[model samples]
Target chain A: MFQTISLFAPQLVLAFFASQLLSTGAFAKRDISIGVRNFSIFVLLIYSVIGFILGKPTGTAFKGALVIDDFSHYMNLIIGLSAAATLALSKSFFQIEKLDRFEFSILVLYCTLGMSIMVSANTLLALYIGIEMQSLALYIMAAFNRDSLRASEAGLKYFVLGALSSGLLLYGASLIYGFTGSIEFTQISEAISYGASPGIIAGMVFLLCGLAFKISAAPFHMWTPDVYEGAPTPVTAFFASVPKFAAMALIARLLVGPFETIVSQWQQVIVIFAILSMFIGAIGALVQVNIKRLMAYSSIANMGFALVALSAGNESGVKGMLIFMSIYVISIIGIFACILQMRIRDGMVENINDLAGLSKSNRSLALVLTVFMFSIMGIPPLLGFFGKFFAFVPAIEAGMVWLVVLALIASVIGAFYYLRLVKIIWGDESSHEFVEAPKTLRTIALMSSLLVFPILILPLISIPTQSLISRAASSLF
Target chain B: MLIAISFYSLAFVSVAAAFMVVASKNPVHSVLYLILTFFSAAGLFILMGAEFLALLIIMVYVGAVAVLFLFVVMMLDVDFVELKQGFLSYLPVGALVAIILLLEMLMVGAAYFAGETKTVVVRDNGVSNLEAFGQVLYTDYAGVFEAAGFVLLVAMIGAIVLTLRKREGVRKQIPSEQIARTKEKGLKMVDIKPGVGIE
Candidate 1:
């Protein structure tokens, strides 16, 4: 019982806040709302700190529905910190947009809770619930600006597609349950370890399709561009950064845990998704004018890179994947912080061309964006290079040279757009007058950008992360 | 043999009613057919020894949901003929999807019948099935039950958030503003105003 409660503490804390916000009208005041938001961030930060400190590996609880381990703890810290930063960054955006409702904070808290649940889930049932919880909050958040037609369209589109994916996931879950005679991951793993069944393969394919949709991988990535383009900017940032970790953690756990035995069956699917996503993300971003859509493609490609690590199917692969995910999310949040600061005549600007001559208008912000762009392009000595290196090295060591080579080519193609953005920022002639970004956004961008250098200098943090990742990887077997 | 006859007829009626729900030309007739479908489905559930499920179907689907559907269908002034105009054009695509679903279901049934998989045997634990279900739901699946509640809560919140709007000129009492009104602001002294009207 204690174990279960501890594992569920983040969600419980969020729920407590949500209930308070709903029941008491006092929290509707702006000051009270800000106070509640800060309290929430503090609570989540404390919870994540406690998770890190008590990183004692608890195998399974609640009859194997929840797993608490180093992987989940690591994820908790990453997700919690990202959420805290997102909330802090939201303040200026909300104030400017005149959307100062307390419900926004409550919804964000719920989204964080959902992500935490997904990271810790061990059963298909728990995993589905977590995914839905997160998706629902996201759908609401996307449509939060109901007065805007674009936001409503984005919300409806996301809701429809998200519902379809949830259906696919449910169908797959039922199929697995039918075949394995149990919904528990351990039982399913045990059942399928001996030999693969066609039914099981089909179920696994469906499940991967659903997971692919969540991660915005190819063939299932139809909704990403539109949703990202249309959703409110801060919500879009949250969508990009927070859910990726949880969903990827889920995929890693599911693939490395229950589905590990039938690697041959699922590995092909993962490879296909990875290659398709890489090429599609690379090719699709080239002609995009919208910065958000471009970032959408960039994220898809990055997920493909991380998926390459997962497809390697080894301890080193899991370690690489974790490092890649953390660094990738950090970079995304930083870049988006810069994007959120883009304004022309007090209205938000999203067109890539609008970034012309950013260096002249605001050199510091431009410099921060440049660092992020280079990191994303996988330049040497940057954190993103190591992220890609770890992701690729494991795959190559596992003898997936073809996949790695193709991924490298795709990265080269993807770099074109990132470089184009950089050129637009620094090289092009000035067009619109740029405004100084909020202090909070600037701080977040600077901190994330600056932290990337530590990975280069220390190189020692990887050692502990590697060991913990391996321990988490071994727990599945 | 009698039980089998009753079960088969119930199943047949349910299936036919379900088809009629879509095939009926009139919207009201369609709703009536839907109610029939639900009734037959509940009867079939009872025949299958799932008494609790049958009661739930009647209570939730027929009692509340179907009635709600009836109200909406009756209240809406939709042109049924115009609505049905596109039915023929949509039929082919819908049929294709239905066929695919049917084939998938058949495949699952075939797999189950092929003896390659084990059928789960739910042992009778000497308690009523309903009692057993409740016990298991409350114990082993309690966490999931709570999560379900959260899902419903989010749905409620989403609905309210999406549809809620403040109307123009709607006087909403702001307690803070009301409470902040001091005696000086709310009242003024009237000293001999009536007697000094000449001035």
Candidate 2:
């Protein structure tokens, strides 16, 4: 019982706070909303610090239904901090838009709780439950503004497709359980390490399909653009960052833990997904008008890059994937923050053309947006460049030079859209000017911009953080 | 032999009723067929000796789900024929999906039989079926059980938030106002001479 508590303390803490906030109807008043937001963020921050300190304890709970280790702890810290930042940035926006419902924060809390569970799950059953819990919250979050028809449509579409993929995932899990007589990752690893059967291979493929859909890789990325475009901008930012990290963490743990021995079979599959996602992301964004939809494609392409690192099937691969995911998430959050502040006269602007003459109006915000675009494009001496470099290095070392070359071409192609947005922001004249962003969003944007710049801060924290990430990565094997 | 015969009969009835559920023109009839299908499925579960699951199906699906479905079907003023107007036009596409699903199911079935497999469930020595189910669910899968509860809670909250509407003109009693009432505030004392021409 003590072991279970230790393993799940973060989720339990968030759950308790979430219920409290919900029961009190915190958002009905201004000060209560702020209080609930600050309290939850503080609690999450402290829990993440404790989780980080716990490190890789090699503790098992409930007969390996849950595991506490370096990888899970590291991901918990990343997810918790991102969630906290997201909530902080959303508070002012909610007040402005009259969307200050207490359910919004409570739902986000539950989603984060679900993500922490997902990262720690050791059994497929637990994993499925975690995923469902997270997706259910997300489905509601996507349609939190139920007054809008588009938001309702987005929610229904996401729920339907998400439920379908979950069904596929559960079916795959049942198949594996039937074949191996175990749902625990360690036991499955033991069984597969000896020899794999065709049934097991199919099961793994189905499972990968499910994870692929969750991460919005190509061929399963149908819902992303619509959902991103239709949901409230803050919810879109939350969707683009926290849940993606959790899903990527799950992919890493499953691939490196149980499916490691059968890399030869799944490697080709990952490579295929990587290649397709890259091409689709590049080609799909060229004609996009909405900035959010464009970012959706860029995210798909970036996930492909991370998958390339995972396909390397080594400790370095895992390390590189973590670095890549972290940078990409930060960049996405910053970009979405800027997008959220694109209000002109009264309504928010979502079209790329509406960004015309942004530099003339708000040069600082324009500069920050430029930095984010450059980082996403992986230009030299920027944070996103390092992310791609770290990921590609491991893949190259694994003799995936061909895949790396193709990914580079895709990066160049994908840069066109980002550059196009930059041109409109800086080079063109606009009829309307951007509204002043809330102080919290401005701070987040500044923080992300500083993190991505890489000149002053890179030397300060890179080596230590890199080594820590590597240590976490090595714990998987 | 008796168990096998009963199981086969139940399975056939369930499959036929399931087919009728989709084939019926009237939405209300479709719901009735769905209830029939659930009953037959529960019978099949009983034949398999999963008495707990059998009862659960009847209670949850037949008792709650089908009744709710019936209510919605009856309450809605939908034009059933109008809803089915596009069915013929979409038949070819639906057929294609059905064919693909059938082929995939066949593949999974083939794979299962081709491999050396063990039955997933083993009969325990001394425990009843309900007790065994309880032990496994509450012990081994306890985390999943709690997560299930979390999912349901989310669903409930979402349903309530989505369908709840605040109207423009409605009188609502403020609980705090009622609770905070004092005699001093509620009552007023008047100092006046009774029926005198003092004024």
Candidate 3:
């Protein structure tokens, strides 16, 4: 019994604690923050241990739906750590709003659990389950503040768009099943080696569409900006960071594992998608006034960068994509944590222009934000540059120099907006003054922004991070 | 041959009701039409020798999800008049997409029918669909299977969370005491005077 229970120890532990937290209404009345912060710490310390242990396990468990492996273990670690940051960020946001925290924290935990499952999933079905679990929790968080009209509208729009994507995904799965006669990735891989028909290709297209929606790739990214803008800042931060990491890993896992045989077929589709996504993400973000919306477009471009690596269909490319996304998610979380800490006369100051004269009022926050902006713009020494550098190198190695060049152009174009934000913060003092920062806000901003220090000092940690990337990517291929 | 009739009937019902679900004039009619579609789809699953899928369709989709839809359609004061807006505007594109889908399906069906006749070797391992399915669901194909369950679970939870709300105009019961009730103290059978009803 102990052994059986131990097989599912990670999931069981997460689920048990999540439920206990829910039933006891433990954090309902408190700062709503205390629970989330503690939960974040608990998850981080525990999962780091479990991730190492998880990678050491061999063979299949719970039938074959789960593969406890080195690759999954590394990804689980990255995803868990990202979610922990989200939790820490959430605590500060809740404390600021004085909103109910029980429901919010539980949703984040469950969502993290879902993403973790997706990274470890051995089947397409498991991946979808994980995606949906993360998505559903996110949808609620988008509209968690039901009182806000925009938030409610965001949730509704997200739901409708999300439902359409899910339909396409299921239809694609069904069509794939039609061709392979099996939904298992390995079986499908074997079946495809013999070759696939147009029906199968169509299914793959629809499958890509569903995933694109999740990651906010172009042509399927219409819902992203609105949803991100409407959602609370912390929720937007989580959206920008955690789920994308999990989703990208799964995307790499799926393509590198079973779909490698048909790279030529899918690569064409992915290239078109990637180029469009990069262009649209960069171009669309340029004009956006809302910081969250700009980030949404930025995310679309980021996913496009990841896709460029995916299109390479090689081990290094996959490894590069994972590492790139890890750093990208870190910087995004750090940036957004600062954004969440911003205060106005009302709840928040959401517009870009409102940030004018920030340096005069809060010099420390402004300086940290400049670091974040530099990283995002791919400026040297900051973490964001390495993310783009690694992501594009794989493309070049794969003989996708044309696409890499396009990505480079897009990144250059994308940098303007980040620089613009910096100008607002540091350039000139405007008439408007920043409202006082709460203790919670100060703590999150200080901690998350300090995260940039490591990225800036990447020379020190690049080797270990690089090795983890190789180890993580080794399992996928 | 008898199996063909059941298959044809289920297929016809599925297609026809699905059409009605889109074409119905009234929102209520659309909801009812969708329920019919679900039932027929379930019946089709049964004819395909997938007993579990057939039951799942009936229990989860037809029984619960469809009922939820019906309740929403029934309970909501939908301004059915506004639904007519842009109907004609959407017709051409919708029709084009539909026709393309139909053509694609027919082409696939033709190929499937043609292929089976060429390789008609029977290799049934005396295995239930459930057994092979379970194996695949757990192993190499496990990701897709779990994704299906997770998607459904998310949808289910989302439905409850999104819809079960307290609207400004609508009254809702508070569940505080409902949850706090002890099994020992909640059930009381006391007589009251006819003119004085218990408040």
Query: Which candidate do you rate higher for DockQ, 1 or 3?
Result: 1
* B1-199: candidate 3 lDDT, tens digit per residue: 8899989988998899999998987878988888888888888877767777888888988789888988888898877677888688999999999999899888876766766433223337887767867765667554455445544554555565556653587666779977888978888786998999996
lDDT of 2 by residue, B48-115 (tens): 67888989999999999999999998999988679878999999999999898778767866877876
DockQ of candidate 1, scored on C-alphas against the true complex (2 decimals): 0.37
> Against the true structure, what is model 2's DockQ?
0.42
Q: State the lDDT at A155 in candidate 2.
A: 94
Where does candidate 2 clash, by residue pair?
none
Q: Write the per-residue lDDT of candidate 3 for residues A124-166, one digit (tens) a residue.
A: 6676777778888888888887768998988889988998998
Worst 10 residues of 3 chain B by lDDT: B114-123
Which stretches of candidate 1 lie above 4 Å from their native place?
A1-4, A21-31, A55-57, A454-457, B1-44, B61-105, B171-199
Ranking by lDDT: 2, 1, 3
Q: Write the per-residue lDDT of candidate 1 for residues B1-199, one digit (tens) a residue.
A: 9989998998899889888988888888888999999898889878767788889999999899999999999898989779889999999999999898778777766776785548465556677768878888877887766776787777777887788886899788899999999999999876656656633
Comparing only chain B with the true structure, the TM-scores of all models are 0.73, 0.77, 0.63
Q: Specify the CAPRI tier of model 2.
A: acceptable
Question: Which ten residues in a row are the worst by lDDT in model 2 chain B?
Answer: B115-124
Between prediction 2 and prediction 3, which has the larger DockQ? Answer: 2
* Better model by TM-score: candidate 2 vs candidate 3: 2
Q: Runs in model 3 with CA error above 4 Å?
A: A1-8, A26-33, A53-55, A438-459, B116-199
For each prediction in turn, the share of the native Cα contacts (below 8 Å between chains A and B) that it retains comes to 0.31, 0.48, 0.37
